[model samples]
Target chain A: MHIVICIKQVPDSAQIRVHPVTNTIMRQGVPTIINPYDLFALEEALRLRDAYGGEVTVLTMGPPMAEDALRKALGYGADRAVLLTDRYFAGSDTLATSFALSQAIAKVGETYGAPDIVFAGKQTIDGDTAQVGPGIAKRLDLLQLTYVAKIASIDLAAREIKVERRSEGGTQMLKSRLPCLITMLEGTNEIRRGSIEDALGAARSGVLKWSAADAGIEDLTRCGLRGSPTVVKRVFAPAARAEKAVQIDTAEKTLRDTADELMAAIFTRQPALEHELAFNSGA
Target chain B: MSTVNRETPRPAAGRAGIKKELPDHFKDYRHVWVFIELERGHVHSVSFELLGEGRKLADKLEVQLAGVVLGPPGEAIGNAIAEAFAYGADIVYIVEAPLLADYRNEPYTKAMTDLVATHKPEILLLGATTLGRDLAGSVATTLQTGLTADCTELDVDTDGSLAATRPTFGGSLLCTIYTLNYRPQMATVRPRVMPMPQRADKPVGRVIQHKLSITEDEIVTKVLGFLPDSQSATANLAYADVVVAGGLGLGAAENLQLVKNLARAIGAEYGCSRPLVQKGWVSADRQIGQTGKTIRPKLYIAAGISGAIQHRVGVEGADLIVAINADPNAPIFDFAHLGIVTDAIRFLPALTEAFTRRLSPHNRDKLAS
Candidate 1:
């Protein structure tokens, strides 16, 4: 019943702001968080570890400073933390990322047996790509159950897991084999605050840092930008629509008059809306 | 433009023109393709939406716009082709298969990538649906090409590069990417992001069918059964004409009722921010934010939502965006068409009563008379 949760350190979006003059992001002074979504995955993994007799290991790939994210994961009651960091891995896209993470998972397995379940957040708020978990599954050849809302049950003895997968409309009761990767959706569970002991242990505990060489990777090409097929040539803000919406003068008009005037204006533009309103009243 | 060639050399570059050896195969790939998503016996609107966008990229490169559709026997098959034509597709490639009855990954990816290999399309687009994201990755991996997920903007630069832009850092920053060396500039956009094209009256298009060489046993994953959503719960929030969305400022679950009341008064649908759903105040379906749902309503009443870029992207399409918040400095006012600096709790009820008086059936009849 061992669990592995993949987390990435990303710039805190709340503090992020676009420069008024340049319209580019002002990234200075913006601190990084453990990808807000990954918190949910880490929390779910911790809960699973608490319920079942197993250890939870947190994994992240970033610059050396990302060790802080791993330490924070350790602080949240995780048994161990692994940081897969290297300069070569800097420009890796999702494809390259999954490749590196998969190699790291294999490395971790060599040290501490293959995890029964792997956890990832539904999608990273930074990338919002939502493909890495599936990518890892494809690379590791693990059954992927994404956008999982809840873990209905897991029978380790039977080697079967039942989970509620979030679909287009509702939740689907998906049953998959063990050693599956589940991307936990937001709002499924609340992240638990670590106790004094947990924080103390994390403050002292060391995070195992592994680069491409240390991860038992035979091919360096598949581990970085060279292996990554996708490239981000440039980044620019979305162009605001040319025509802006006109704001009607409602300074003197009362709320009632405003609503009435708005309705009349809308009806003038869309004559069918008036008919639809007429129909809503069973006229 | 010469530098652009240096940047994106296609077909593994010329043998004499400095070809950086790629993995065995994937040396020659060209043209552009779009995946017209057909699910549950009907074509998703996003497919047409992608075609409208795909038409631009194809014209930019002076290439043909081909749609790859995988579906069962039905009018849906023709509808996809017809809709693709209306949306400006030059060719609609169909892969009729019983294995693709439901939106499963294995067979559809096989059909799409096979078509790409046989008749290579340099760029491929798919609607960012549950089905699309699932299928795109596998296909991209199999083809050994780069794939960008959840792109908000796609354009072909003067150098004939597919520049895909998407929000990064949680909609706080935008990053434009190029599938520089990869063939088939792959991208997926959520439904409603691209404007729907007008339906052409005639079938101004061509069709080329592909052989789907896949069997049920070949794919390990199986859709054992299908469960349809109930009518009451199936709320298509994306295209709702009148939308009332609440945010963290709503305070609590009980306050969300005010938003619902206002929505009811205006004959609108109600939803909330991701925070509200996180707080367990609403279902995930009702969450309206960057990662939740992108909506384009005629009128949008946002109460308590301090419109972050993440939320703004989802609601930017609203014709009339009226934001109500307690904080006058809330970002929602920056983009909102109309704004009122007032407490959402108090203002929501007042707006509800105001809409009620104006939109009441009795008042409508009286005004008509």
Candidate 2:
């Protein structure tokens, strides 16, 4: 079995800040980490390879610096890493990104072997669209299983798999054929630490880098900004409300007394809500 | 790589990229349609919310607003269509089939995509629920169109393009996106982001029936069973009347107990910010944020949360927001209606005790009556 995991390097969103005056991202000193969600997919792929006796390859598309994320995946026990980077791929939206990636995956299959499965994070924190995985599945015509919580079983010989897919209001136990694309749910499992041997091996095994042409993308119009259908017209912070919170001072009041004051304030503002809460408290 | 000529097909250079003329095949695409989502014989409220939003867009575009309903052939489908009309749909498109009863992607995608191919609509809206997100991604990909998910705002620009605004870069900022060249621009908005429209006593609209082209044998995936979430962990935080959520300010996972105690005392749902879930202080289901859940409670009590833009967007719809944190400068205080600067670890227990006293059996019985 060959499992290909797609990963991305994104600025740590927790530390990302928008300039208050300029309305631009303050990215000068922000650290870049492997998108936290992608780690979940990478770990799941590693576990599958461990059980099924197959190779795991980590793939990413970004600037040359994104190769660091691929190397990190290599240290996590993936057998190979591939980076698809080029000047033409900048300003790509989810649609163009998936087009570049699907073609690269096809190239990877030809150079190595066709993968039985492709794994992607549910979504990137930066993009937060959750479209690329399904987009890839559609372009490749593969069965797409998203928000997957667990892999129940796999019949390698029959090329079948079963999974618990998270759905609205319930969990769906779904069975599908192999060669499918999966977007894994976060926190399903903790990522493991790399061993000394694994780190050393990762240092020795450099990533397989590919430009757009190398990835078999010939349509320049379809490679980046030109192919992206969605365009960002403007970006700005949400306007701040004029009224700030009415501060409940705790300096003089006792803790319990403070709570009482807060409750009184709430009732003063929304007397109807107090009754509404009582009517539905049973819920 | 082939170098392409830009002049022959250039339409106009807009803000993000070059906008192109709508292909001759797509020039006649008209109307704005909202997919009325039905799950387990019930219509999801988000679908109605989208209809309300779609009405605005339809009016802006000077086109008819329609509802697309796909479900099993039953009274539930009829009821959904009726509600759609009451909620402001000018027309209704129905696709009835047993295969669409439970929403397998293969058949539903084919049905919706086929409908789009046959009757072209300029804009398609859906709820960003589990089913909608799953279905929208596949359908958009199949149609080779653009889809914006979890949009907070939708409008028609001067050029008649759909301008979908959503929080991006982890909710640090809002960006407006346009599907400049794609027909039937698709977008999904989370529940409660748009206000529910007033339901009028209107008759059913013109219903157009479509067909599903696939059968069960053709679908590679099958739903073996569905297990509803247990009552204890239901964590219906999205629509709760009162919500008490903890954050990293609690300091330790054990301190989450204080949050729960307060929630129980007030008969409120409890949740935490995304970091707490990542820290395993709480499960992902109980996490509150853009990625976890978008909640619109009547009252929200946020303890130890700093009110990142991501968390703010989720809780902004609360009728009243009360933020408790040690830092008075926390962003939560900016939007919260009330603020208390105190350690949540210590304040929570005291608040729980206060509520316990205020809601004694005698007072509770009086209030109940």
Model number with the top lDDT = 2
- DockQ per candidate, 2 decimals: 0.32, 0.52
Q: Which stretches of candidate 2 lie over 4 Å from their true place?
A: A276-283, B1-17, B365-369
Most DockQ-accurate candidate: 2
Query: Clashes in model 1: which pairs?
Result: A235-B176, B30-B122, B31-B121, B31-B122, B32-B121, B32-B122, B122-B184
lDDT digits (tens) for residues A28-81 of candidate 1: 898988877788888989888889888998898888888988888888899999
List, in the given order, the native-contact fraction of each candidate: 0.30, 0.62
Q: List the TM values for chain B, per candidate.
A: 0.90, 0.92
The predictions' CA RMSDs to the true structure, in order, are: 5.2, 3.8
Q: Per-residue lDDT for B285-319 in model 2, tens only? A: 78888877878887899999999888988888898
Please provide, for model 2 over A19-112, each residue's C-alpha lDDT reduced to its tens digit, 9 standing for 90 to 100.
7687677878988899899999999999999999989989999888888888889998999999999888877877788889999999998988
